[model samples]
Target: MNITVKFFSSLMEYLPRSVEGNAMAVQVDPGTSPRQILARYRVPDEEVRTVMRNGVFLPEEDRDQPLEEGDVLTVWPSIQGG
Candidate 1:
């Protein structure tokens, strides 16, 4: 299955070189979920501060929420300040 992924802040560096800004498309198994995708993409769990599935916030406990075709996933990394 194919889905859209948008990473925020420092997470953008994990994206492909050709990926612009913080968004890109990726392929995954039919039953892949937000957390699974992150792991599959090698994104650190700590860096995944937020998750939005199709414009809705996806709770950590709900990581197994089924991903459908054309789903849009937005990932925001935790922000820190001195």
Candidate 2:
């Protein structure tokens, strides 16, 4: 299965290939969970502050949501206070 990932802030710099924009396409196994996807990318669990599936916010408990082909998952890290 494949999913679209959109990163924000410092996360973009960690990507292997520099994406001018804030998103990329990644391939995952069928029935992949959000936690599994992030782990594959080596993204620290704490760094992921927000999780969205196809433009909808998902609760932490729902991180196990199974991904489908062409699903887009956007992750945003929390910004610290000024």
Candidate 3:
């Protein structure tokens, strides 16, 4: 299946070269979890401060849930402003 992964803030650095605008469309196997995808991309656990699927918030524990086709997984990092 195909899914969209988006990295926000400082997390954009982790996106692959093929990805543009902090987002990418990639292929994933059936039953693949968001956690697995993050691991595959080597996204640090601490770097992912937030996770949203299709505009809905996804708690840390729910990252293990399988993603469906066309699902948009948006992840953000903790940011501090002075």
Best by TM-score: 3
Candidate 2 — which residues are off by over 4 angstroms?
A: 79-82
TM-score head-to-head 1 vs 3, winner = 3
Please provide, for model 2 over 1-82, each residue's C-alpha lDDT reduced to its tens digit, 9 standing for 90 to 100: 7789888887776566756688888888899988788887799988888889998987899998788999998888885677
Q: Itemize residue pairs with steric clashes in candidate 3.
A: none
> How accurate locally is residue 36 in candidate 1, as Cα lDDT from 0 to 100?
82
Candidate 1 positional error at 20, Å: 1.8
For residues 11-78, write the lDDT of model 3, one tens digit per residue.
Answer: 88889877779889999999999999899889999778889999998998899999999999999988
Residue-wise lDDT of candidate 1 within 1-82, one digit each (tens)?
9999888888888787888788888888898888888887799888788899999988999988779989999988875689
TM-score of each candidate structure, all chains considered together:
0.86, 0.84, 0.91
lDDT of each: 0.86, 0.84, 0.90
Which ten-residue region of model 1 has the weakest summed lDDT? 32-41
**Candidate 3's error at 25, in angstroms?**
0.5
Candidate 2 lDDT score relative to the true structure: 0.84
- Candidate 3 lDDT at 50 equals 83
